[model samples]
Target: MTERQHTDQALIARIDPAALLERTRSWSAINSGTHNLHGLTHMAALLADAFAVLPGELSLVDGDAAESVGADGAITRLEHGRHLRLVVRPDAPVQMLFTGHMDTVYPVDHPFQTLAWRDANTLNGPGVADMKGGLSVLLEALRIIEAAGTPSLGYEVLINSDEETGSFSSARLIAEAACGKCAALTYEPALADGTLAGARGGTGNFSVVVRGRAAHAGRNPQDGRNAIVAASDVALRLFEARSPALAVNPARIDGGGPNNVVPDTAVLRVNFRPGDTGEIERARTLIGATTRAVAERHDVSVEVHGGFNRPPKPIDAGAARLFALVKDAGSAMSLDVAWRDTGGVCDGNNIAAAGVPVVDTMGVRGGAIHSTDEYLLVDSLAERAALSALTMSRIAEGALS
Candidate 1:
């Protein structure tokens, strides 16, 4: 082993459990939903303070304007809060990009508002495992690295507020920051067993609004072309577009009226994950054709919003080497690091698209994410911090290129 490896081993042993848990507790308490601008702004300020431990200029940059369709089919632009950008030694010989999201699937009105202990070592709450715990791991790992000494490898940390909603506003920022970096790590939560995500499918979320003539059910119903029925038809077509490689999910449908009225407006929200770039393009074309065909067939007007944003993160040679580095780091601590392809897309996908190799699920081990049952294994906080510290230190030492 090299002298740098010795230093890495020493630093990994310095992982702090108490501080990690405290940070997680602090972050998970806030409900930073994608649409909660106030909550996200507050969370960004808190994160800016916590990340101040590292040598970096932490600043909040305004996110891109996001669009939402109203019930009347009017598109409105909304802000995605602010994105936190941290730069440390950007001119250093080695460059890396680390990313995560501060937002959660839960909203302010969600009943799962606070963290509760499932057991002495298990903490449950929204965003606990999904990413708040991951951010804690990231912070501690960087602190460990900086404490060891100033690193030769400079890194950029982007904590965007809109990733839960497909990174509508921060995709450009993520890609631009990753341009010159050799490697990237996304702090999305890992499985309970500490496995990472290897290849990830590119995902696109779409909202299709259908409009038709509305009429009272008890009156001349024939004068109305039911939009709900048209929207349902579009939903079925999208679902049928799925294949063994392309996974399509008709997540939800909104804008239905009372039973006594022939509903003339309906919105269908759907998401699809494609295994590769070609598949993503195919999905787009198919969806467009299907939407037009369905609209014409049902005599309705259709409007579509959103498209594929993150390109697929394939486990090519570059990505495989990156995973090997992480797995080796894990093995040093008697931890067997493993990974598999996930259909779930993340900001890591965007980074990988920039030709940077990335291991996305480097966060704390947790499960039952995006739900009330979300929980984090408290021990993994210290364990994964050590693992990340080792990986980062090695990367800084020119072990990975």
Candidate 2:
């Protein structure tokens, strides 16, 4: 194959499992929830500090938070920003990007938010399995490659602050970094059974606001149009759009009177996931039609805000090739690895949808993600990291044909 691939395969032979696990535990102790600005900042700084020790020049990519006003004054956006970059080789042709998120779903006050030892071989923590553990694995993987003292391809690592809530502003940055890159690896945790994700559905979050006149409930019932009822109808329409492969969940409904007058306004928070672009278009059309029909029939004005925040990413031809490369690397290490399609979407979907070939769920294998039982297998830290390091090195060496 190529010299880069050969170099990567040779390095995978000497990856140290113990060092990998130690680092995973180290990072898992820090809680970096996407909604917790302070925690996110601390996590970012920690990552930056750690990367500073690497051989390549490190650069920070700046991002700003969107703000809103609250009763207490102006409420700053929850997440501060993210860190991204390229760890370059003196000379290289292919560029590979490794990606992971520093943010988790758990909030600062969450009871499920700290690191604990499930056993000598397992780590229990909020962000441990979902991704902080994965980040650790990525770093260890890179360390293994760097220690080999052979460079195959220049690489970049993109860590973002806002991934649990759909990546918002960071989506564009991911897309931009992916341009001309050969492949991408996202360190989202693996399935409970160690299966990597081959394909994932795209996610879209939306809001529907129903506006109706408010009047005395008992004295002037006819004068008031119930926005709540209009919103309910809209919710029902949304659920009716669900199919076997597609899902629609109306997460929350807000607004209404205290049983005294008609509700002037009501809002519906809805989210959906579609496996393909066609499903996304169909869902958007259905939502629009249903919203308009409900508004007209109920005599209420409706405003629909938000659109497909994250496009659904399918395992296209490019991704399939990328997955094979990872699998090959794993096999060489005597690890039997396989991939399956998943319904849950992550930042990988955002990158893949932008036309970059991605091997997501390329993180430590673990179980119970997003729950109190969340834990990561200590052994997976080294195994997966070695797998990643090998893949990158092989790609550089032109080993995979």
Candidate 3:
């Protein structure tokens, strides 16, 4: 091994695999769903204790209230947990940002709660890969850096509690922290083959409430408007709006009544992912037109909620350089790292929107994320942490440029 590889190994040696896996297991034991306030609070407290081992000013910031339209069509604030922020060296020459989410998609009622050994090298659980293990990797990398002594660069860490729900509450915080930083890293779990996500499409989740007049199906049915039919119109229009690069997923429809009655209310949920800003604007226009058309035809009141929350994450020149740095760092340890464009959006989109270069997936290699079969590779705990440690150490010493 090269002399620098030796130094990286010495630093990575501090990342004990057993300790990392144990920490991951402990974290995975907690059900910190995006909507589970109690679970999030518990997980946040544990994170505070674990991250305290590093040198920084750690604090929790409450997530901004998110607004959602209820069945009665009333917009209300959705409660969420506080976000964790830690600033290690604000005055250092080089600046970087690191981010991860404490929330998972699985709710408290979800059956996939416990971690079990799928095999000798794989552990399966609700969030073992997407991404309690990622946070473990971030903490381990930072621990190595702190042990190596003072860093030459400044860095900020933001572990938010609302990333799984579109990061609406912590969007401002992420943008504020990422602004003016030279580079950013988000631990969002890499593919089992080690390929990180590259340029991403934008995602917009919309809820269309269709309200119409109800009447008895047996009497004067023509006098009443059907909300379910109206919602179906809107769904069809949304489906027709799909383009070659744009995807439209009609997720669910809520509010239906007995077959004898013409339903008065129906809610249609549609999710769209656009390839770029052009597609985003066009999508918004098409959605507005489609909803208006359907509501007018069915004589129903339509209220649309939600929009493109996460903009596309395009890999610009600066982001490419950041990717190159990670590639080089991985190469140093004989780990070939690569990336490909993805339609999935994450906090990396918001950070990249702030004009900061970001390599979003620096976490452990895993598969079947957001599913009951989600599994984390046992050895990736140390392997990914080592890659991150080398990358961070290089950035701190200004060797990345």
The candidate maximizing TM-score is 3
Q: Model 1: what TM-score?
A: 0.94
**Candidate 1 residue-wise lDDT at 161:** 93
Model 3 local distance difference test score = 0.90
- Give per-model TM-scores: 0.94, 0.91, 0.96
Under the 3 Å rule for N, CA and C atoms, how many clashes does model 3 have?
Answer: 0
Q: Which pairs of residues collide in candidate 2?
A: 2-397, 2-398, 3-397, 4-396, 4-397, 5-394, 5-397, 202-312
Clashes of each: 0, 8, 0
74-165 per-residue lDDT for model 1 (tens digits)? 68996787999999998899999999999999988888898899999899999998899999999999998888885588999999999988
Note the residue pairs that clash in candidate 3: none
TM-score of 2: 0.91
Residues 138-200 of candidate 2 have per-residue lDDT tens digits of 887787777776555777778888777777757777888787788888999997667988777
Q: Which whole-number lDDT from 0 to 100 does residue 8 have in model 2?
A: 54
lDDT of 3 by residue, 1-401 (tens): 77887888788778888889999999999999999999999999999999999887999998677898776556789888999999988888888899999999999999888889988999999899999999999999888888887468788999999999999899999999997788899999999998999999889999899899889999889978999899999998889879876889888888877888998988888999988888888988988999899878889999999989999989899998889889998998788889999989999999988999999999999999999999999899999999998888888777655
Scored by CA lDDT, what does every candidate get?
0.88, 0.78, 0.90
lDDT of 2 at 29: 73
